[model samples]
Target: MNLPVMRVLLAEDDPHDAELTLERLAIAGLDVEGVIVNNEADFIKALDSGTFDLVLSDFHMPGFPGSEALRIARSHPSALPFIFVSGVLGEEHAVDMLKEGATDYVLKQRLDRLPIVVQRALDEARERRSRHDAERRLRESETYFGQLIDALRDYSVATLSLDGTIESWNRASEWLFGYPAEEVIGRPGDMFNLPPEPGQPTERPLVERLAEISTGTSLAEERWLMRKNGATFYASVVTTAIFGNGGAVRGFSRIVRDMTDTRVAADLLQMAKEQAEAANRAKDRFLAVLSHELRTPLGPIYAAAQALDLRQDLPPECRRSIELIKRNVEVEARLIDDLLDISKIVNDKLSLRLEPTDLVAILNGIAEIFREEAAARHIELRYTPLPYPVIVQADPARLQQIIWNLLKNAIKFTPRAGEIGITMYQPMPGKIAVDVSDTGIGIPPQALKRIFDAFDQGEEESAQARGGLGLGLAIASSLAQRHGGTLSVRSEGQGKGTTFTLTLDDPAGGDVQAPAPVETPASPSTHRPATILLVEDNGDTAEAMQFLLAEYGYEVDIAENVAAACACIDAKRYDVLVSDMGLPDGDGIDVLRHYAPAADQIAVALTGYGMESDVRRCLGAGFAIHLTKPLDIDHLIDVLQRDNRS
Candidate 1:
């Protein structure tokens, strides 16, 4: 079969030989396109300007010598098939020309042999062209695949020789390891792993795993690997062995993905949880210490004010001012108590003392306390009692606190001359509801949902002068729920007023009865003078207690710390011992521990530390009563007088 056409350059000077060569090339199974040239100028010009499959030349030319033509063709950029077609040349000359980069020589006299020689020469040239194209395509494909691997940003890809020496690295590998291809190629692959961390086993290193995979499969594992920047991170690496067709190991490929971010995120979440818990603990501790610090000094101030109120020598105005001082001091103490209660409620630590409580009586008692404050603000406070009293099984003190917080919140938001009313009734058959309504700036519709949220004022500072810490309503709501009740609010949007209703469980199924009187002042009672040991840490509180006890006809010996109280107890006997729970040196419980006072002698606990746990521990330590500060001196005197009578 005839091959495709071949383009030939003929440099023979003789016209006869050039025509014969062209004719023979055409007769061959392949087609031929020939350019004939003989002189050095035309031959060199043709060779330089034209593309040919073969070059045919004579031994000598008119101007361009055949040797020089051969030299020109050899020196050209591309390879070309050069053949001699001279019939006059000696065997030695022809052999020498063949040695000078010639394909073959054909004699003009043996012209019949021309077709086979041309066909053979053209066939070899076609093979050489095919070989060059294949090699170029192979080089391009290798470059494209290399770049594809290098473009992977999340994985580090590397190529290693069979002996575990790095042969090539993609750009991603360079980025992850901090080593460029120029610096790392031909080095051992172990350069990626520096000194391993402690407890890193030496039994199966990366090199060993790579060696195992050299048999033709892939090995995947997770390990702690190092980087050129001296950082260590966990990575998932896959080592695959590349094999040749002969089934022999050629080289290896490694792909690695870093696993640091997910691990660090989990660790950070755990750390954040720990920090939040620690902050909660710190807040609780601060509240406990704050309660002690706030109430300790107020004990002396309130007692002093109460003692001053008892003076018959004072004018009516002075006595009235003293009563205001005492009333406001009680308000300050209640504010401190609310702060502690809210903290306890938030931390899930608050406990209530549930009993059979007359809801109306509890409401009426706390209502009287706020009347004077309301009158001062020119906001009339009124309590509309039910026709009959409604009683519930609930915490009386906590119930009073809930009612008090509502009144306080009302007074805080109510403008001057605004009226506040507390209406008590049975809203349902099994429920008793106390609705405290105020004529004030009403709540917005959006804010009504979160008005009872802790620390949520829900009102602008201009609308209401800020007084409390915004936790009062939150505590009220919490206390109501604790007593099997619900506290909710209703507002007619912005300009209208708001009403807060407290609904509690009515455990007593029978009909309501006439409400009992709330409280009456202790009638000026006379008590015998008694020897008392008064243990107080604050000097002001100690001095004030002594004066108040003297007024109540008792000889009081004051002690400032646990050590002083212990000394006082060891030195003398007393009728009653008043000990503050928290002392500078040790707990006031220590004094009770040192000297076991007889049951007949009153062991009354006077303490600024007032939580349920604190009261329980004080009672467990043999104190007859646990009285919180700013020690209600009137209540204390009543207890003392009642105990003396008993």
Candidate 2:
């Protein structure tokens, strides 16, 4: 041991023994600072104010003893070492003092060893203090690391040893995996009971994978993990090797995030995008088909009317036949408009005007309208009365459209002498159900799955013979869904009758008085001749309309441009004006606004854009009727006939 300076306090009543001890310590090569206290008061004062590295006390004193000095030093914050020096003390007494926390005990006669004993005790005390500081630092570091892990909420943090044993689990891990730290701490990672593939023996054989990780490898992958209740969810896992002081691999730390909901949301969004694209394609196809269907009939009606107008000596019967052609063309145009409306409904672009609608009255009106169609088909159409007055919250026009389409479909499909039955009844207290059944070729079992889909048609021979565009039921179903109701079909395959049921929830209220009906105007026979101006850019279409209208008793004036139509409007007061929506100079709306026709003078809009917004804008612009071309001759005749008398 190296020689060092030592501060020593000596408490003894014998002056001889204390002198001998100091001399022996000096001879041992220690630089000694020594204080001798022979009484209790002096020893207490010295211990209170003085500092010493070691305390050497005699076993007995006049007023203080070695045992008393040891007690005093033990109670101090800075615990000074006490070495007992005694000549007469028994072995049992020395053993008791040592056990009571004395640093060491030496016989007074053996003063030569005092310096060596003092040096050893001081070195040991310094070592104990260093060890205490190191332990405190280690505990603080552990606490800080634990808090860091607990603060994370998004992902569960955990660690596994080289054997795939769970060594640590954080608070987030406990919450996410539904396991307490105590339960999972020493368990294997695969004890969570994950899903096993067909022939796989274990859910996640992480032990084999961890061996590679412990050898300084890294892994990043996605796997499904099981919860406490055995429900599996996807997780993104990242693991890497932890290193020791010498850069050797230690263990691994893993971070996992649950991706089950995220994956599901992504899939759903992709599906919706695909559906929107498909709907757009269908809309494009419908518009193309509608354009072809409307333009086909305009050719014949225009030619017949033009021929009749140029003939000044035409017979009365020949003149009437030309008028008939004009009337039928208008009817066909109306049918096309109806079909376009159904397309809007199918695409969920149709808006409704909500009002209190009387279902019975609407059904009755539909029966009257389709009575002629049914008669012509030689099919008997019947509507049975409901047990109670059924009033519903619905759009009146839309409801009429729904009932009309269903009725028309029934009449079209039913063969001659077939029976068609329509019944309205309250299936529940606050709900109304309408059933339309036809004794015709019924739907097949295989085709029933897609019957409500737009453009879907049945394979029944009769339905194929009496062909349709297959949009009626699709429109009906969409309307029903909009009304918080449903439309369903039931049949016993082909050759049997079919029933379509429409169930609608009734509005909140009891029965109320029904509204008065508006009667359709009587069909006119006497055609009044009036001045008319027609503006169209297409030569063939314009020539046809002028001839057809002139032959039907109208003084028809035709213009191929906006400037010519404006000239005619300024020169003469016409009873009615007909214009194509798209013109060479401007649109029809521009022509109508420029002329600023009187309120009494009727204006009709004819265009190929048959969207609901298109029709609404035309009507909002003060047009009396919105018609899309190819123009229906009969519908045009009705409108013209109505305007002629007005």
Candidate 3:
């Protein structure tokens, strides 16, 4: 459908001869378009135009001879064929002219041969042009590939012979292995390889048929290579074989990358990790000691206050003061508990008891906790009760804790008469969002990003006035994440107000039916007053614990050391052994070992060391239950009664 256009320059003085030549070229099956010139100037001009493929000239023109035209054609950059078609030329002259540069001579009387001669000359010229074009393209391709190969300074790219010898190397090879191409080439590629480690089988690595089945994959392992100076560096290398048309091996290409820095960095990172782990262990040990020192004294203080509160003959003012003392003591105990909990969370030790619970009921209970506090501050606390139960799969206690934290912060930062709002709504299917918003001093732009970080106070000026460790939001956020949810905050600006939202994926829709309830183990209904051996080092704590146990129908024997406890155990049979972890003679666990094998008795640990690991250690020592100090008497009674009945 498409054809090439060819330009022919016909150098003939006579117009008739030029017309005849054009007609003959067409007849010879030449697809040519021609330009005719009559003189030396026109012929020279046509040659200078540089658009013609074939030049046919009259050998004996008035000024321009066929020889002169041939000379001019040779002078130009392109090779143009010049031919003689003259009538006045003798046989000798024609032969002489042919020897001088004319392509072929055709006598005028034999003008019938002009087309034949013209066709043959054009064919040879086309073949020559094609060969020149292919050579030019080859040169350009070699130049481009050379530039690309030299540009790679990171990879030691090389070409190899089929026998695993290096044939060529790039600049990276010189820099990486410290070997110049002159020395490395024609040498076996394994010159730098060390032997495989013990227990690894020897195999030829370079000739492995990797690329035949896979385009790319990581090699089995990193190999060590020796440098020119005898020092070793690790290298990650890959070799791909070059294949040809019949799937025959045509040498190979190997690419090597320096991994010495990566190897060194990995070692450093491992050391850092070990150091961090050691630091965490030390921190845990310190917390254990601190918890024991702090909580041991609180046990006696709380018990003494309770003993005072129970005095019927005491004055009402005195009773109120004792109650205040008890409440403040409980507050201090709660702060210590918070510190322990945060440590547990940081160490990924926070455990959860997940159950399908009524979210609405939990929210209502949280609202009731802060109602008095909100009123004391002259602030409005508002929440709408849910008409129906919204059940969710969550740890009920943790969920309550998150809400308590946000509500406490809302109450703390809000000024007197400021409004605080708590709202819960399902914005869409498979979604539940709870928002706690307040008209308080909002967070500034600079502090917003770090508001959820532990101990980061958004309002530095109010940190002391607010009087908190600023760990609530951090704990809340962590708890939310552990629940497969998120907690985020937004503020308009300082003094404008802030809103915190908690979002959870509600795959269990509101309309979904609840599962049938499971039965719980009922306590055995039997009458029994248990005997308790209270082993405590502190005199006041032991006295108060014994007094509290007696009120619950427990006959108590006090032991302030391991020897005293062992004596009491040998003398009398006891139903429960309540002991502190630390003792003057030995650990409380040693007392358990002495008494536990003698009888079937319930052992309980009432200790000041209250980390999760400490509890595990106590449980591992055969205690039925591990309880921390500043004891909740009701919970203790419940535990004691359950074990006594069992």
Best prediction by TM-score: 3
Q: 378-455, model 1: which lDDT tens digit per residue?
A: 999988655666778888888888888898888888889899999876777877788899998889999999998887
Task: Please give the range of 10 consecutive residues that has the lowest summed lDDT in model 1.
Answer: 519-528
Residue 217: error of model 3 in Å?
A: 7.6
Between candidates 1 and 2, name the one with more favorable lDDT.
Answer: 1
- Which residue pairs collide in model 3, if any? none
Candidate 3 residue lDDT tens string, 73-150: 777786787778778878787777667766787776677898788778888888888999999998999888877877
In order, the Cα lDDT scores of the candidates are: 0.82, 0.78, 0.82
User: Model 2 — TM-score against the truth?
Assistant: 0.53
lDDT of 2 by residue, 60-174 (tens): 7766777888888788777888889889877998998998789998887777777778889888888877897899988998899889888888788888887878899999888
Candidate 3 — which residues are off by over 4 angstroms?
A: 1-136, 193-226, 229-234, 260-270, 307-318, 346-349, 356-394, 403-453, 457-462, 476-526, 531-543, 556-626, 642-646
Prediction 2 global C-alpha lDDT:
0.78
Give the poorly placed runs of model 2, Cα more than 4 Å off.
Answer: 1-293, 296-343, 356-358, 375-378, 384-393, 460-465, 505-530, 538-555, 598-602, 616-624, 630-646
RMSD after Cα superposition, model 1:
12.8
By descending TM-score, how would the candidates be arranged? 3, 1, 2
Q: What would the TM-scores of all predictions be?
A: 0.58, 0.53, 0.65
